[model samples]
Target: MTGRDHDHVTRVMRTVSCDASAARSRLAASWQRSFAHHRLDPAAAPPQDRDTTRLAEQEEMLGRLLHVASPRLDELFSTIGQSGHGVFMTDARGLILRARQRAADEADFIRSGLVAGGDWSEEAQGTNGIGTCLAEKRPLIIHRDQHYLARNIAMSCIDAPVFDHEGTLIAALDVSSPRAESDGFNQLIGAMVSGIASKIEIDLFRDIHSDRQIVLVGDDRAGTALLAVDRDGLVVGATRSARIGCGLARQGALRPVPLRDVLGETSEGLSGAEKAALTRALARANGNVSAAARALGIGRATLYRRMKRLGISGAD
Candidate 1:
């Protein structure tokens, strides 16, 4: 190795060998994991290209998510592509499935193993952005030298985890730049990447639960506060944030709980609630009384009687 490369690896080893409590920062903790848990060598050569067949299989498994996340990936690239940034999306395993980079900067990213089919899992690449974010299940920025590997110290990586409708982590969105940048600039880019990831999650959730009533429960800055309610006003699904924040089921089939019960409401509000539910169902059905009635688990005649009692009109 070159003198500079050797020095970088030496520093990484020293940091990782320090006392556990002394390395309390996230970067330090990741370094510890890289050295102890993963047993990675910071000075090791870059990973080999994954086989085409394996990549195709991973792509097929994530086909639905790729379709939902394509536009958002384009949007993110448009925002940062010209600034020497490469946008990447990885499956839950940290295998990059798709990437968008300017033609001029493509070779550099490829050499650094930032292209599609590259495995950036924490176990594979140590304390890098895409892998570490997926490992921790949160948004993060691995700025330049924060990367455990000396070969990756020149690139800044920002990433965020993408969860599905049921709040299970499904993928990660990342933006990486080889150009030197200020910490403030990296923070701004990190937020943008995180926002795009959240948008992808929201789109995926809506696509999966299109037939249900989607309710925004709280601040959605993280885009996890979504609940899917059925026509009978039962919450059938919840996003990760909603599940944790609202105390709902975390896994498997969610128990059919009344929306009002989940929202901590009383029976005194039943009339108003029923009217609102009917209106929403009708709107979703495009004023088709039979369809809306079916969605609400009621007969067409019963729905018409309730609509009349509630003074709702505009139905055929």
Candidate 2:
């Protein structure tokens, strides 16, 4: 190893073996855990790939997620896989269920233990990209020698967590390569993975709430967030971005809020946005005509007239 690389790993091992509360970042904490809690050998070889004799078994295991995310997976790979890097999708437990690499780098990727069915969870692989990202519940790029194992120093990886229909984290998407340019991995790859993860979440949210009144919140020219409303116009569920867009609490999903309580403006229930906004506003104000009207910035008379036309009931 080069002098700098050796020194870097040595420093990490020392921190990992001691108290690391001063480490504010997740990556630093992970590095500490790799050697301290896990007692993993920092000089160990990279994770080993398992035989794919039962490849169908793994595919069946990830059937629901694969079904929901397959199209976008192809699109994601088509967009990003053609480059020197590769993409891997893993189940919640970090078993690699799918991998896509360009023709030029497939051999190297397979040799690096990125084949389907390989386990990359923290419990198994220490502080590499997929394992650490899954453990920390965040997106990250583990570049070059940042990997805990000496053998993994040649590679860099970016990973993003993917949530299931119930909003449970169920998978991760990893993009990486030994051949990747450091600047590009830092500048663009993380965002690309995050956007793909968000799209999967949006699709999953819609699929789960197909019968409900689902609306995407945000500016039209910009992107949107996914929100699910009930018959009474209560916001029942939202994607992470949607929650942020509507100013909902970050810790737990926000409590059931009326649509109008959150949206700032309203139209006369003619357009989709207007209707969704009015419905939520009326629900939030608890059917009090004047109150709901005032919240919506419309006159009580106008609210009453619109309610009748729109067939909204229980307005006092």
Minimal lDDT window, size 10, model 2: 265-274
lDDT of 2: 0.76
What's the lDDT of the predicted structure labeled candidate 1? 0.88
Off by over 4 Å in 1: 21-23, 221-224, 267-316
| TM-score per model over all chains | 0.85, 0.73
**Residue pairs whose backbone atoms clash in candidate 1:** none
Backbone atom clashes (below 3 Å) for every candidate: 0, 3
Which candidate's TM-score is highest? 1
RMSD of each: 4.1, 7.9
Error of 2 at 218 (Å): 5.5
Model 2 stretches with alpha carbons more than 4 Å out: 1-9, 18-24, 46-58, 218-224, 243-316
- Candidate 1, residues 141-201: lDDT per residue as tens digits? 9988889988898899999999887778889999998999998999999889988988898
lDDT of 2 at 159: 91
